[model samples]
Each structure stands twice: as C-alpha cells, then as structure tokens.
Target: MKDFSAEITYKTSRSSGAGGQNVNKVETAVTAIWNVMESAVFRFDEKLRISEKLKNRINSEGLLQMTASESRTQVQNKKIVTEKMLDLVEKALFVPKKRLATKPSKGQIQKRIDNKKKLSEKKENRKFRF
Candidate 1:
C-alpha cells in the first residue's frame, strides 16, 4: 500500500554463506516483521484478507514475518525483506475474477460421435465372412 515501512520493524542476525570472515563478524541477515492485526496502512477488510492469505507466514501473535539473507550487507538484506513483505501483502489483497462454467457446443458433441462410428464401421468391415 502507501508505505507500510512505518509499521514494519526489523531484526538482524549473522548470515550463513560464503562471505568468509565478513559472515562471522557481521549480522547481515534481516527479518522484517509487521503486525497484521494492528496495521493502520490497510483497512479492516484488507487486513483480514492479508492475514487469511498469508497465514503461513504469520505467527500465532498475528504478526507477519519475512527474512532475507541473500546479500552480505545488513542494508541490502533489510531492503530485500521489506520489499518481500510488501509484495506478499499486495498479492494477498488481490481478488481474481470469478470463473463461469460452460458446456461444449452441440456441433462438438456430434463430431465426437461421428469419429467413433467411423472407427467402429471400419473395424466391422475387416471381419472375414465366407
């Protein structure tokens, strides 16, 4: 929505990767947490939709959490997690168009029957009658 950054809080930890000494010395991994139940960026209905759709990512306390550790810097990882959370929230709020059920045309049904009869008659003619 319109910048939910204000509602997001971050936690950082040491990242595990091939960063050598840097990985051991610095806390590069970042986790972005947002309280879906207490968010002011989204309306009540939108918040409910986000909670329902992102239930897997949300904790029992109704907080949505995302972690990013791909990069070797805290700033990059923080940005990554924030972007991820925003993208997820946006996806959860999306409503797909309803699908309508339809049946095949009469012409299509006729074609299937015609093909079946043609094969049956061809096999019948192959019989040996003396």
Candidate 2:
C-alpha cells in the first residue's frame, strides 16, 4: 500500500552531471519531499521513530527532503530519489536484535585459571634464588 507518487513532492534544479551543454541548460536534478503527517507510507509509530531518528534531517515543518542531482537526466534523478527514500523508510522500520546475557562456561573459566597459574609459575621461576 505504498503510494510514493502521492507521498512525495518533487522539484527539479540545475544538474551538474556529465551532459555537456544539456547539464548547464536544463534543470534535471530532482528534490523530493515527504510529508510525515500526510503520507500513507508510514504508520503512526514508524513516523514517530523516523522523526526522532532523523530529527536533524527533518525541517521545522516535519518534512523530509531528499535531493538527487547525481545524474543529468530527470528520470535518473527521480529513480535515485525514490531509491533513497525507500532506503530511509527501510532503515526506520528495522529493529536491531537484542543480545542475550550469558555466563562464561565452566571449561572456559577453568582454562583461564589454568593459564593464569601457568603465567604466575613462569614469573615465580624468574625471581632471584634468595
């Protein structure tokens, strides 16, 4: 149920890509805006998390802007913007798996103690014969 067309607003700017005269003349770079409150792309909790996580990226109006000027063509810029938006959305959705608490095994503890005893023995042997 991801309707990116309605969710995003695009604005084009002059591109610096390798298009010779076309790059300087045509405004092909794409800048897209996603309205967090209005979009159907993210749920309530997801939007909240995204807002919190990307607080610096969001403007005072709570809009997320992504600019793509890497390519000369408008189509390519549009595609890049879409891909970047998707990546941001996916990153917001991800929850890191928690690590379980674990105690060292008896064998591991025994080996560590054994190693310490060996080290102590070696140091003791190096002491002056007084």
Candidate 3:
C-alpha cells in the first residue's frame, strides 16, 4: 500500500445521515482532502497515472475529497473517512499488468461457426416455400 501521510489533509462537518436526534446537534462527520499537487509520496509518473485514473473524482483544483458520517461520534467518522481515502489512494496507485493480445483457439472458433450454422439451418426451416 502506498503511504499517504503527507498526501492527505482532513476536515470535519456535521453528519446528515443515520442518527436521528443527535445528528442535527453534533458535528461528527469527517471530510478528508488529499491534495495531489502537494503530496511527496507520488513520483512524476505515479502522479500522472493517478491523475488520469482519478480524473472524475478530483476537483478542478485537483483535491480528492471524501466524507464519512456513518457513526455519530466524530472520531469514528474521521476513521471511516480516512479509511475510505486510503482505499481510494490505494486503488488509484495500483498498476494493472499489461494483457497479451490473443486469438481464439481453433476449437472455440469452430464451435462458434458450428453454432451459427445450426442457427441458420433452424431459421431456414421456419420460412415458407412460395
């Protein structure tokens, strides 16, 4: 997992979901922001890869924001938000191995052609002779 200690910043706000009575009164939810531009963890290539993958998630200023308010307690919510942010960063940093281009096996190709021939024969039987 990529270390994101320097990459992340956090803020708190009132939670809007779940807890009924206490929800309105307490500011328990946490909003975590990871500023990609300021992070020392990402090398130039890694940064570019992350930026491209997270194009939709990042704001115009390039800050990735995550909010969690599941629990009524501020600390719990903070933990949730941080966990989510870390997961996002981990996913963004992951590099999928390149796939080798391959053609269908001869047997599989023959099977597909046979199926098409059978289907065409079935359709031909449905038509009426004029």
The candidate that achieves the highest lDDT relative to the unseen native structure: 1
TM-score of each: 0.88, 0.89, 0.75
Clashes of each: 0, 0, 0
Per-residue C-alpha lDDT of model 2 across residues 1-130, encoded as one tens digit per residue: 2545667889999977588999879999999998876767768887888888788889999999999988778999999998898788678767899999999999999999999999999999999985
Deviating ranges (above 4 Å) for candidate 3: 107-130
| lDDT per residue (tens digit) for residues 45-111 in model 3 | 8878788988898999989888888888998878888888788778988988999999999999999
Q: How many backbone clashes does candidate 3 have?
A: 0
Every model: Cα RMSD to truth: 1.7, 1.9, 3.1
Q: Which ten residues in a row are the worst by lDDT in model 2? A: 1-10
- Candidate 2 TM-score, C-alpha based: 0.89
The residue-by-residue lDDT of candidate 1 on 1-130, one tens digit each, is 5679889999999999889999999999998989998987888998888889998889999988889999988998998898888888888899999999999999999999999999999999999999
**Candidate 3's error at 120, in angstroms?**
7.6
Model 2: residue 29 alpha-carbon error in angstroms: 0.8
